[model samples]
Target: MIINAFILFLSVALPGLLLTRMKSFSQKRIGYFLVFAGAYLFSMTVIHIIPDLFLSEEDPFKLGLYILIGFFLQKILENFSNGVEHGHVHSHGGYSIPYLLIALGLHSFLEGSIMTDSIHSNHRPDSVYSHGSSPKILLGIVMHKIPAALALMALLVAQLKNTKKAVLLLLVFALASPLGLFFSEFFGHSDVLPERYLVIFFAVVAGSFLQISTTIFIESDPHHKLNWKRFSISILGALAAVAAQIGF
Candidate 1:
């Protein structure tokens, strides 16, 4: 768990730190990366996560409602984040940094909260999968986090106008996912979250993934036309998710 948390932290921290060494982050490149991450997130949620949710949850309708809640909840976060999770970080002169960090941090926290190892998933002996997500969900999170971190640092540097201060703010944002993993595990082991609530949490995060990924797909192609290159990248990303599931 310590190692897992540290890696999650680095997923946010290292990318932002790299921005300190570079003059600017490339939006064109980040857009392509977001497309790939979106494909992976959408694919993983459809295959691994949705199946796991159904397996652990008893009431399908109730679970579906929570998923909807998470879906709109992400939309609400975007109002504050200005689409930071989507890798489109823009600066408004009057924007509040606290609100931006809280919005983005909540989503990151939820992403980490889903990392308990088969906590409520009562799989058969022959079954090879667990609840929440496959271990390789870490890869998807890191993939998305890299660009988000880059965008976030870019915004912070512009807003604060001091690299040191921006990076310091980035450090606080970086702690979010690791803290989510830590607290969730700590509470789950201590029985603070009953088995049922654990499933609910997973369902919520799955919904958020659906929102984030689909928004990326839609916003990436505003003209509603297929770009063959992006289509190929999307296919590759889905393949990566499948490979993660089957142990490739």
Candidate 2:
């Protein structure tokens, strides 16, 4: 768990640090990358959400309820986040830094819950499979989280001039997934989340992912032209998301 968390942090923070060296802009190239990342989020939700839902073996009515609940709550978060979890950061409003961080943290916690549940899936005797959410989700989170973190950091820097506060803010962002992992594991054994509720909880997470993807694509300005480089990267991101879904 410690190693996994460390790797997660390093992957995001290091790349963010490196990228910080360059000027940040949401250019056509970035639009392509963002869109590709959004596609991956969508693909991952499709590839993984239904299987995890079915795995619970709960009633159809109950499952639907759970999915609906997830959809609604994620919608609420979007109202506040302007759909940051979807990879589109909103900056026009007042700097609700704490609120945004908390929302992002909640999203991270759901991600952690997915990790814990996927690894300990009681249906499979072999805990570690060639393709499972355990590793794949972790990898996917690592791949995209850095840019998300960097984007957050950049916004903070732009708003406030304190480097120390900005760095600490980044650290807090970095810790979210690990914190989620811890709480998810705690809840697993506490009987706080039954199979019926687990389905809903995870489904909500899927809804969140889907919500984020939609926000990214819709929020992107179409004034940017399509280019070969953008096309290729988008393909890679989409394929990677699919691969994670299929393989996991």
Candidate 3:
């Protein structure tokens, strides 16, 4: 767990420092960054989180419910975020920063929770490191950081012009996921990590991804109807998630 948190911390912090360099771009570039980050995280969730879920002893019905539950919770978050995760950086009178920071922190931690939970649930001391989420969770958190980091860095550069402040904010952003992982590992070790709670948590993760992706689509191209491309891709994401749930 310690190793996982450390790695996750670096994953998030590095992107933040990197974001300090993107100060001259137009809003379009910022939006593009958000799109890229969202896409990247979505892919990772499909490719990683879903598979973890499948490998665990969780059942199909429960998994489905988790998805629905994730969907709604993410929806609520989106409403509060005003679609920030989708790429549009609408400031709510300077309230956006603190609100976003807190939201991102919560989001990161939950994601990390999924990883640590997986490890503790499935791994024994003699087991390979393959089961612990320290790595994948790290990747997901890093990937998740890109969008927010990009937006935050760009804004900071445009106005604050203080690399130090930008970097500091970025570190704060990076810690969110690791913090989540910390709680996950802690709760898991207490022998109190109930299956029902995990099911709900997984549902939230899946839902957040779905909500963010769909929100991006709606914001980017509202008239864009659900064509085969989106449908197929979404199904692929769902399948990937399902497979992860059952340990495949």
Candidate 4:
């Protein structure tokens, strides 16, 4: 758990910290990275998380309904977040910073919550990473976090107009996921929330992952023009998820 928290923190903090020193950034490169991360995230959900969720004897339709709720819940959050979770950036343009953070932070927290290792052990007994999330899911979050940190710093810089202040705010964003993981673990161990409820929480997060990853793909090419480089990168990303799925 500490390792996940540290790594998750560094994934964003390191990139955002470095960007605070720079005068310019390459959104194009970051976009490619988002593409790959999105692919891996999507594949992880399809191959692992969703399957594990269904491994429960719970009602499939109900679980799926919760997933659909999470999918649109992310959409609602995007209305406030301006789609920042998937690397979409927009002009601050009368948008409240607090609202964006609340929406995005909720997202960050839930993803982290699902990272609790014991939550999925019964479901993922076949997984090599039997502890927390399968390696692919954690990697997916980290992969996306790097580009996310970049876009966030850009947005915050544009709005706050102070690198120091933006980095400070970014630290809050960086810690949100790990806190989710930590608290989810805490709740499970203490019986603060029942294990079945945790599984429901996992389903909801799975829905959000679907929303975020699909959005990345759609937004990556609004004009529908084929970009082979991104195409290949996405393939590579999916393969990486498959490798993790098979315990490679």
Per-residue lDDT tens digits for candidate 3, residues 6-96, read 7777766665577555444466555554444455456666665665566556776778778777878867765655554454556643535
Worst 10 residues of 2 by lDDT: 122-131
Residues 91-162 of candidate 1: C-alpha lDDT, one tens digit per residue: 444567899999999999998887666454454434545533536788888888988898889888888999
Higher TM-score: candidate 2 or 3?
A: 2
Over 55-138, each residue of candidate 4 has an lDDT whose tens digit, in order, gives 876799999998999999999998998888887676646667899888888989988877777766556476544544545577
Top candidate on TM-score is 1
lDDT of each: 0.83, 0.65, 0.60, 0.84
**What lDDT is obtained when candidate 3 is compared to the true structure?**
0.60
Best by lDDT: 4
Question: RMSD to native for every prediction?
Answer: 1.8, 3.5, 5.3, 1.9
Clashes of each: 0, 2, 17, 1
TM-score, one value per model:
0.94, 0.80, 0.68, 0.93
Greater-lDDT candidate between 1 and 2:
1
Backbone collision tally, model 3:
17
How does residue 102 of candidate 4 score in lDDT?
A: 88
Q: Is candidate 1 or candidate 3 better by TM-score?
A: 1
What ranking emerges by lDDT with the best candidate at the front?
4, 1, 2, 3
